[model samples]
Target chain A: MDIFLTLFINGLSEGALIFLVSSGLAIILGLMGVVNFAHGALFVWGGYAYVWIYQMTNSFILGILAAMLIVFILGIIFEKFFVSRLYGNAPAQILITLGLNIVFIEIIRLIWGNTPIAIKKPDFISGTTIINGVTISHYRILLIIIGISVLIIVNYILKNSKTGMVIRAGVQRSDMVQALGINIRLYFTIVFAAGAALAGLGGALYAPLAGNVISTAGANNQILAFIAIVIGGLGNFSGTAKASFLLGLMNAFVAWFIPSFAVVTNVLVMAIVLAFKPEGLFSEGRKSILRLAVKK
Target chain B: MKSLREHIQRDFSKNVIIALSVLLIALLIFPKFSSYTMLNLLTRIFVISVFAMSYDILRGYMGFINLGHAVYFGGGAYVAGILYNKLGTTIPVFILSIAVVVLYSVICALVMGKLSFKKGTSVFAAAMLTLALAEVVRNIAESWRDVTNGTDGLIFKVPSILSNRIFFYYFSLIFLIVMFIILRKFILSPTGRVIIAIRENEQRAEFLGFRIENYKLIAILVSGVSAGLAGLVFGTFNRFANTELLSITYSTNALLYTLIGGTGTLYGGIVGSIVVNVFQNMLLNLRSIHPIFERWLIFLGILYIAVILFMPKGIVGTLRHFIENRKVKSDNEKSSKTEKAPGE
Candidate 1:
């Protein structure tokens, strides 16, 4: 029972961390219909920025915020210049973003010297507690808190805010939104940057959990996020959240029993999903062409 | 009677034929006069150029991007290494490996095509799926230590006939020219034109009662078989097989080659491969002169971006576009002059 509880918490925390990364991807893909291949690069930058600032200032909050800020700026640049130019051209977008991915990843290696940088959890949350015969780590609890809050906050925004309304509309028809006199391009930049910042936040939190920041981590997590997006349905937010949790729980149980299966789980799940339901398990299956391309 | 320049200008095909035959003749005699390094380098280019050409069938012709393209190439090399190691490096074993490679490439293509080419699958989904599949294969290869040698890479001996560098160099050159002609023919075939039509307007192709998916699957199969063959030749040339062949770097290298040379143009891949490989070789040579030269990937990435942004049609595509535009301009001038002559 104690093991079960531990695993559950562990899994939820894992799912929450994944959520932080994939949520941005889900939003960006939803709003802009832009598949940002350099998202992994943005993620790595976030992690390195977090590590750099954390080491210098020793303030975890500051590091996380700084990471988000740096990545946000990078996101704006990518959307405005490179990705914006290649709108509606999926192949070119993929190639250009992939090129940017390679360049940015190499730049990370250049700055950080190609070695993994060690990191530690903040002093406050780096502790353990015993409750009702259950041993729970404070950090996991903190992760759960952060994860739920982000979900609730984002959900609230999507449900209640004008920005959410625009994003939702943009997903279906950005042109219609533009015809309605909303600055859809500004919204594109905002959503892309916000998604990038979320990825940055995920990276900052991820470093202490993994115990180090490495350039390759971005690629690895990017794959994980891709899996989530695939299973959850393209550009579906709530679906992404559900899929992320499902993956996390599945991974935790698999790791406990069939460790080898853990490595193969993502691929297996993805392949099965693709074979059976190419639209994804949680897809709305809209016949909207605009979401497929934000054409000029 | 026209001067030599005017005659050549009027008859483009004859001039191209003359230029190509002369180049081919020179290359046939190249090994004897060239140094060993030059011979080896050209041999490598010939083998890899086939791989690039195969990649162009998908990227250039069909407008599909398979990020796991290196899997077939890497799979071919591994098959060669493993079979040679297990069953003795005989001519029969080499033949057997070729057969195995074709079957393997076909099976992989079927699986990849079925998943990525499904109805409602977006461009993003296909790209991500292929990448995930490639990574899965790489992981499996890594963990299967007994066979793949656990990423330290599988090195084995080949038949002595293949080991003869001059013989192998000639072999690869023939392989390149033969494959190029075959692919060019394939592109011009009825089925190939249907595939190109699908690329131009998938909806129109579908509405025209063509099974676009089947055509795409065929494209994948042809590309796969060619890539696998190239990989086998590359392994024979180097006498080595590594998992790095399966890496995204190689897949992207294929992409870079096709993009630089011209995606749809069959020979563009050859040009791109030659240009990229030569540049890579030059950079390696420059490493002793500067520490910065060691990090060549930065430059590779920059080149990728620059080519896509500035040279979107690639070297061959851009050149062809320029030539076609000039021809149109000159023809317009000649037509106007003829009109004026009638008036006079």
Candidate 2:
């Protein structure tokens, strides 16, 4: 029972982190039709930024804000210069984003050196709380709270706001959105930056929990985010949340029970999901999760 | 005068003969003229060229961008390594290894095709699926310690005949030449034409009663086998099989080489592989001069961006475009000159 409880909390926290990373990816892919392979690089950048800022300022909040801001700016620059040019070209987009990822990762290496950087949990969130004979870390609770709150805020914005409406509509039919007199390109840029900010937030929040951040962390997280998006239907927020949680729980449980298979579990789940439901679990009908090159 | 079609055919055949003779002469004399290091480098280039060309068939001809092509390449190497390790690298064992690697690659490609080429699947989804699948394979390679030795990798000896550098270089060179000829012939075949048609317009090809999936499958299978063959040569040359072979970086390299050489042009793979390999070698040599040269990946990343931005068609592709344009201009000028002379 104790093991199960611990696993459940672990799963939820990990799920929240995944959700943080994947939601942004899903939004960008859905609205802009760009895969944005450098999304992971942004996440890594955020972690590094958070760690560096936290060390300098001794304030987690300031670190998180700085991380998000830095990544958001980077996202705007990326969307403007690199991604904007390859709007309809899938191959070019993949190649360019992949190159950007390499560049970002190399830059991180140059800045941070090869060693992984560890960030300590804040003083207030340093201890554990026991409930019903199960001990849960305060940081884990904070992560869950922050994750749920962000999800709610994002959901509310998407459900009610004009920009959110434009983004949602843009995902469905950019041509129609353009006809409606909204600059879809501007919306794309905004959404991309917003997504990058979310990824940054995820990285910053995850750093304390994971204890350390490595340059390759971005690539690893990127793969997990891709798996989450694939499993949940791409572009579906609710689906992403559910898939992230399920995958996180599965990963936690698998790690506890059969440790050898932990690394393969995420990939296996993705493969199985792809085999059974290629459109993904949350997809409505015949909508392919990722639309390739849009024929002009 | 002969028809334009006949003239073009004659010219094409003449070009083919000249190219083949040049290739043969280069193959024969290259080792004798170059140092052992250069020969080794050229051998690597040849192997990579075969791999790139196979990739080109899918990306260039079929218009399918497979981001996980290293699966087959690495799969072949691992299979060869395992076989060689177990069977003592005898002639028969080597032959069997090549055959097994090809079969394994075909099976993998078939499975990937079935999963990704479904009725409404987009190209991005397919690429992602392949990437995911390749990562899974890499993980397996990493964890399957009993077979792969995990990250430590498998280092084994090839047969005595292949131990000599010059002999092995010539052996791989011959293998590359033979594979190149086979690929060239395959590309010019009727099936190749159908595959090109599918690339040009899948819907039109389907409407014209061609089985697009089947053609794609055939193209992938051919590509997989050739890639597997190249991997076998690579593994034999290095006498090692490691997880790095299964990496997405290698797949990226293949894409980079094929794209830089020009898609659909068979020789573009050769050109791209040569250019990239030589450039990489140069960068590696420069590392001794400056520690900053160790940051070769940054340069490679910039190169990829530049290629995508400036020369999407690649070196050979751009060159072909230029030559064709010049030829058309000359043709126009000659026709005008004839018309003017008659008028005068």
Candidate 3:
């Protein structure tokens, strides 16, 4: 039971981190209809930024903030300069974003060198704590808290805020929104950057949890986030979050039991889900957001 | 003599005939004067061009974006490598590898087509699924350390004659010509027409009583077989096989090659492979000039973006567009000799 509890939290924490990345991805896909393949690069940037800041100041909060800020700016630049120009063009988006992904990842290697950078959980949240019969790592619990708070905060904002309404409207009809005198382009940039920032924050938090950050982690984690987004339904925010957790739990158990299956399980789930439910398990059976996203 | 000359002029362009003969003659004798590196680069280009052409069958001809195409290409290489390692490295083993690759490619294509062509699967999902399926194969290869050697990559011998550089270059050239002809024949066949029809309009093709999925499967089958064959030859040429051959980079390289040369045009793949491989070779040569040249991928990625943005139709496609446009304009002028010409 104690082992189960530990594993459960471990899974949840893993899911939380995945959610951080995919939620941003889902939002970007929803509003702009562009699947940011460069998302993984952004996540890597966040980790490197966090590591750089943490090493300089020894402040975890500052590191996370700096990571988010830098990634947000990058997000804006990507949207304004690259992604925006190719709006409504799906294939170009994939190619350009992938190109950006490669370039940025190479840039990371250039700066950080090829070695993995090590980091530790901060002193306050470094140790494990016991609650009744359940013992949990403090850092993981913090991650869970951060994940949930971000989820709630974003949910609240999306539901009640003007920006949220505009975003949802833009997804349905960006031209319509533009006709109404809303600068849809600005929204696209802001949302893309915001999504990037979330991925950055995920990276910042992920470094301590994983013990180190490596350049290759971006691609590996990007695949996981892709699986999550696919299973959750592309452009469906809530579905993506659910899929991430399910994947995290599955990964945790698979790794714990049959370590060899760990690599295959994520893809296997994606295949099965794709085959059985092409619209995704949680999707509302609306048109494929992808079809709607592309230019005629 | 005038009749014969008129017949030749009527059937084919004199420029095309002259160009083809000149290019073929040059290819035949150029290896004698070329550096060893240049000779080998051409050989690699030949094998990889076939892979790109195979990819064109799907992406250009069928409008399917398969992110896991490396599965067949890399699978062929691995099968060739593994078979050569386990069995003896001989001409017979090479023949046996061809048989194995054909079977493997067919089965994988069927499964790949099935997984990605579900009832409600979108193009995006299909693409992602292909990537997932590839990752699964790669994962299996990585873990199955006993057979695959666990990503350290399998090094093995090839048939004796294939090891010779000049022999292999000519051999790959012949291989390229054969595959190009075969692929062209396939594209011109009735089944290939239906596949093109599906690409142009899936619904209309379905309504016309063609089983869209079956046609798609057929396309994938042909593509996989050819791509696998390319890999088989590539592995033999390299005397090595690695999981990297099964990676997204390799798959994307096929996309890049096809895109650069212009998709759908068989000759474009040949041109693309030559252009890309030569460009890559040049970049590698520049490594002595600057340490940054070692990171040529950044430049490659930038080139990729630039191609997608500015030359979306690719070199051949754009050139064809221009030539075709000019021909149309000239034809219109001939038709309306007195009327004002249409605006560009």
Indicate which candidate wins on TM-score. 3
* Candidate 1 per-residue C-alpha lDDT over B196-296 given as tens digits, one digit per residue, 9 for 90 to 100: 99999999999999999999999999999999999988987888888789878789889999998989988889999999899888988989998677777
Better of 1 and 3 by TM-score: 3
Model 2 misses residue B174 by how many Å? 1.6
Which regions of candidate 2 are displaced past 4 Å? A168-184, A285-296, B1-20
Question: DockQ of every model listed?
Answer: 0.72, 0.62, 0.72
Pairs with steric clashes in candidate 3 = none
Compared with the true structure, what per-residue lDDT tens digits does model 3 show for residues B133-213? 888888778888899897899999888898999999999999999998889778877898899999999999999999999
- Order the candidates by lDDT, highest first: 3, 1, 2
lDDT of 2 at A75: 94
How much TM-score does chain B earn in each model? 0.95, 0.94, 0.93
The DockQ-based order of candidates, best leading, equals 3, 1, 2
Instruction: After superposing candidate 3 on the true structure, give the runs of residues whose Cα lies further than 4 Å from its correct spot.
Output: A131-134, A284-296, B1-12, B333-344
Each model's lDDT: 0.87, 0.85, 0.87
**Comparison by TM-score, 2 against 3, better one:** 3
